[model samples]
Structures are given as C-alpha cells and as structure tokens.
Target: MRRLFCLIVLYLLIGGAPVVAADWSLAAYWAKNSPDRMIDILRGLNPEMRSSYLNAMALNYRFHQGRRIHWEVEAQLVRHHGMQDHWESNAVLVARWMDFPWDRWLDTRFAFGQGFSYAWEVPPLEPRSDPEDGESAQLLNYLLMELEFAPPAPDSQWSGMIRLHHRSGVFGTFSGVEGGSNFIGLGVRYRF
Candidate 1:
C-alpha cells in the first residue's frame, strides 16, 4: 500500500508539471478471458478462450494535449461474470499517439496505459495460469494497449477500439505473485 501510494504521488508530481487543454471521454468495452500470457498474446498466439467475461466502462480525462502525444488519466468500473462473479476497478495513466501519416486516409490512434487494479476478491483463475507462482492478490499492477480508428474526418468524435487488458504482479511487487490475468477486449469510445 505504501509503495503504491508513493508511485502514484511520484507520477502525479511529474504529470503536474504541465497543464494544457483538458478534455473528457467515455468508453465501454466487453472482453473475454484468455488462457495465454500477455506476451504470447501480443506475439500473435491464438487465444484459448475461457468462459470468463468482463464488461467495463471508463471515464477519461486528457490533461495534456501535445501535437503528437497526449496524456490522460482514466478510471474504469468493471463487472466480471461467467466462470466467476466479482467486480474490479482500475486507474491508469495513458499516453496516446495522435499523429499518423495515413490520417488522411483513415484516422488511427494508439494508446498505452499503466496503473493499478483492485478486485473485489482474489481471482481464482489467475493462479491457475501460473501454477508455480500460485498466488493471487486483490490488488495488482494493470496495463492496457489500445488501437482505435475513425473515419477520415478529423472532427469525428466516435471511434472503434481493440484493447488488450492485462494484470500482473510485476515480479512480486504486489504480493510475491509472479503472474496474473489477461483479457482480449473489443470496445468503442466517444470523445467530447
């Protein structure tokens, strides 16, 4: 708990160095659980589907808007069901890339976020993915990678997204737990 607080304070200290045109957004997504690790999933390995699913909604505050890069903080409320039933929440700081060469053809964006995730209860399926580590925590490190696109119009407010939702212990940083869970999610976003 102390470590998490310290990290958040440090991140806020750095982020507070600048304030720009702030904006807000709302997003929602539905994700299915995968039996593969985040690395393998990103490497194009086929996902082994599980019955677990999560529906999530997020509110994003973009605090900085640079020409090529933007910074945002996001809060998510997620509901989990299927193989298990519970609730999870996440707070993340995201970095978004705004300028793509082919924007005139099809507008595209990529964003990466890192932060913390807290579950209503320790997830049972998490330890099964890493039997050797056999430890799961209610609170863990969270991360996401999202790619979204819209029409060629620069003023478009709606876009579709495919995101990778991941949670991990970061080599025992949380509770001497080495592994966690991953979800392949599809969603949409509306920026206002």
Candidate 2:
C-alpha cells in the first residue's frame, strides 16, 4: 500500500504538466501532547518539551495556480525520537499575502492539508484504545503557518523558514479521535 502511494505521488510530480517548481526541506522538531485546545495551542509561542522529538524531510511540488491561490503536494517522512517513525503524504493548498509590508524581509504563507499517515508503531504519547481522547494511525491532517525569510539575493535558491507544524484527527474524523500533536520547527528550504 505504501508503495502504491509513493508511485502515485511520483506520477503526479513527474507526469503532470504545468508543475514549474518544487522545494525540499529538512526540519527538526519537538512534539508533545498539549492539554490546551487547538485554538489555545495556536496562540502559544513557546515550545513545550513534555514528550519526544523528531526529524522530518519533505518534498513539495507545486502543480496548480489560481488568481490568489496555489496548490502543492507534499510527502514527508518523520523519524520520531531518532527512530523510524511515520510517513505522511498530503495534498496542500496555500495562500500567500504578498502585500505585507514586511515582504522585503520575509514572505508569509498559510497552508492546510488533509492526508493519511502510516506509523511503524502507535504514537508514543497518544493513547490507543480511547479514540475520543487521542489519535489514530490510519488517517491524519496537517496545518502550517510559515514565515520564509528572504535570501541574500533576489535569485538565491535557498531560504529559511520558521514553521508551526500541527497534526490532528479533527475531532473524531478517525474513529472518534480528537486530540493530536504539535511541533515548532525551523528549517531551510531549497528551491529546485
């Protein structure tokens, strides 16, 4: 099943026309179970070290364009706490507000994705049997808000980003699981 998903993503990235750009990034993050609600989680600024840590690598392919919106597909591999952990693949839609006064210094974008994740083992911090209180391995969702710093030159191929990474089940979407996980990550993005 994983092989099939990878093949599909490869096909979409290579065979599809109109895809003009792609980016790859590597990030390290710390994740923990938050007692706070989703909105509260979003409001907090500090990283919590209550659980474990992971490293992630992601490939993003931009395939579509609209007047104010763009679309991309992202495939990510996450190594939880230095162990082979999980794989998450998603189709993401992004919107950037280019008119921000800070554009000369950085770019701001908001992205949302819905996808599936496969875990080598049940997530260490999330409870398994009680779906109403935790998460599931079969399906998941992602949310991100990123600030991409401008490079030294206009044509520079590399940039840095501070991102808020979030994964959740969306309140019983996956067998009644509601809560999930959050990570604050810093990474560099290389455009190809």
Candidate 3:
C-alpha cells in the first residue's frame, strides 16, 4: 500500500511538471485546531477549541482548465506552533468550481482536494479516535475544502480564502487509526 502511494505521488509530480512551468498559484493560511470531529465542527456543535495551530504555504499547479471546472495539484509545507510543534507536508489533487451567478460582484470559487499527508513527528493532537485500537502515525491521508473570493476585475490575481485542513486515517485505512485531526484556517491565494 505504501509503495503504491509513493508511485502515485511520483506520477503526479512528473506528469504535471510541464504544466507547472506555464501558470501556478501560491496559497498560505493560518489554521487553528478544533477538538471535535470534522462533521460535528462543520455543523457548529463545537464550542471549545484546542491549543494547536499551524501556518502553511502551498504551491499549486493547474494542469487542466475547462470552461467551469479546473484541475490542480499542490504541494504544501507546514509549521505547527502553539500546542503542537512539528513540520508537515502533503501533495494533493484538487478540483475547483469557478463559475458562479454572482461573478460580477465577487468572483467565487470552491475547491475540494484529497491526497497524502506526512508529519515530521506523530502530531500531538491526532490521537486515534478509538484509543483501544489504534495510534497516530507520521503519515496519513489529507483532505482540504476551500472557499475563495476575489474582486470582479478579470486582471485580479489576489483572493481571500477560508479552508478546512484535515488529516485522517480514512476509517483505519492508513494504519489501525481512525479519525485524526482538523484545523479551521483563513488564508490568501495569489495566481500568476
């Protein structure tokens, strides 16, 4: 399983290299930990938060552009501070929605992506959901959901973004682990 994961990542990077030279984007965010499960947090059930925090920067390359749907791959580097101090990295494939009815007022895009996440150490907050069965690993599955907004001008290259950064075991697929950790983040994106 691990070998397959490595090969998939290599293929993405190598196959997308040519497109990387054409146009690329940069994104950065400041994220804070949420103690509850991702869905519960999204449903607004959590009131308390964890002490963990991170700042992440990602370089994105868009290889396929359609009329309304676009495809991209991004590589990220992260620095966790506050309650957890560690380095993390990931590479993801993203599908973005670029068409909206209100484009003249505010250009909006929503994106969802999934890939692999690696930690320099076992992240302190990523305790296994079922403590009796599993433990956190230095590598796990990564997922992200982002909403971005920019000005109406076609020449605009800057935007504001909000995202949910998640690392999970995919129901014990990565290891014996289950649900992992989540962070709610605010950030910016620049396209060039």
Candidate 4:
C-alpha cells in the first residue's frame, strides 16, 4: 500500500497533466474518541464527543486552476497511543469548491472525496461496532472544510490552514453499519 501511494505521488509530481499551480501541505490531526454521524454534523446538529488521542499525519496536494472547482489528492497515516495500537493508510481524491470569499487574507474551500483504506486491524470504535464488520475491505469517504490564510507577502511561499477532517464508510457500504471518524487539523502549505 505504501509503495502504491508513493508511486502515485511520484507520478503526480513528474508526469501528471499540467496545472496553473499546485500546493502541497502536511498536517497532523487528532481523532475524536466518540464518532459522530457526518449527516448530523452537516445538518447543524452538533454533538459532544471526546478526543481519542489517535494521531494522524496527512500529506496533500491541490491541483489549482482559475475555476471554482479543483482537484486534490491526499494520503494519510493514523496511529493510536497504546502498545496494542495499529496503523491505517488512506488515499483519496477530492473535488473541491474554492469560491467562498472569506477575506483578503484567507481563502475558504469545501470538499468531499471517496477512496479506499486499509488497516492492520479494524479500528476500535465506541458506541458502534466495526463498520467494516471485521473485514479489511473498506470504502473511505471524507468531507473537508478549510480556511487558508494568505502568505505574509505577495511572493511568499508559506501559508497555513485549519481544516475539519471527516472520514466515514457512508452508512455501511461494506455491510449495514453506519460508522466513521472525525478530526480537526492544522497544516502548513507551500506553493510552488
């Protein structure tokens, strides 16, 4: 899986179609201890959930253009804190809407993606059983809303963003279990 992800990124960097611009970012996030239904959150239904201390690192690339819609590819690695902990790898392609006008210093975007994920073991969940039903084959879906702060100067290469990362199985695509995960993240992006 790691080899496949590396190859995909290498291709993107060296052989992908030309784009007006591209941005790369690296981020770390903490998963919520109790999972929430994505629909509920999107519908303005907020729930109280605790932090799980599960840490994750995400690497992303955004293919930029002048249009409102753009594309992004992301790869993530997740790890837990205990000795019994395991790692999970997720890769996804996102379609994004980048039209929101927040301010002169910020750019706002919303996106959703579908892809596949693999875990050494089924992620332990609270208040719900394994959505994959102990099977490793899982469909991954994500919703991301991000705020990118503009660079300090016109030609600067550095910027920052805060993002909400929501991951789920989309109501049991594998079986009949409605389960998923969420994280709030901060990242630094470099544009070239």
Q: Cα RMSD (Å) per model? A: 6.8, 9.4, 7.3, 9.2
TM-score of each: 0.87, 0.68, 0.86, 0.66
RMSD value for candidate 1 = 6.8
TM-score of 2: 0.68
What value of lDDT does candidate 3 attain over all alpha carbons? 0.87
Report the Cα lDDT for candidate 4. Answer: 0.59
Q: Which digits, one per residue and each the tens of the lDDT, describe model 2 over residues 1-192?
A: 999999876654344345455443333333434434557657776534444555667677666643334566667776666322554443344443223455566654445555555555656554534544755554566666666665445676666766666666777676666766666667777766
Global lDDT of each model? 0.88, 0.56, 0.87, 0.59
Ranking by TM-score: 1, 3, 2, 4
Per residue, candidate 3 scores C-alpha lDDT tens digits across 96-160 of 88889999999999999999999999987888455764678988999999999999999899999
Clashing pairs in 4: none
Q: Can you write out model 4's per-residue Cα lDDT over 1-192, one digit (the tens) per residue?
A: 999999876555345354755577676665444355555555654555654546777787876433566678888887765332667777878666655565345655566666766655665552245434442223455556566666435566666666566655566664443666665556665655
Reference-based lDDT, residue 39, model 1? 85
RMSD of 2: 9.4
Tens-digit lDDT string for candidate 1 (1-192): 999999876564344445545588999999999978888899875778899999999999988765567789999999999987999999999998877899998899999999999999998778854468868899999999999989988679999999999988987888988888889999999988
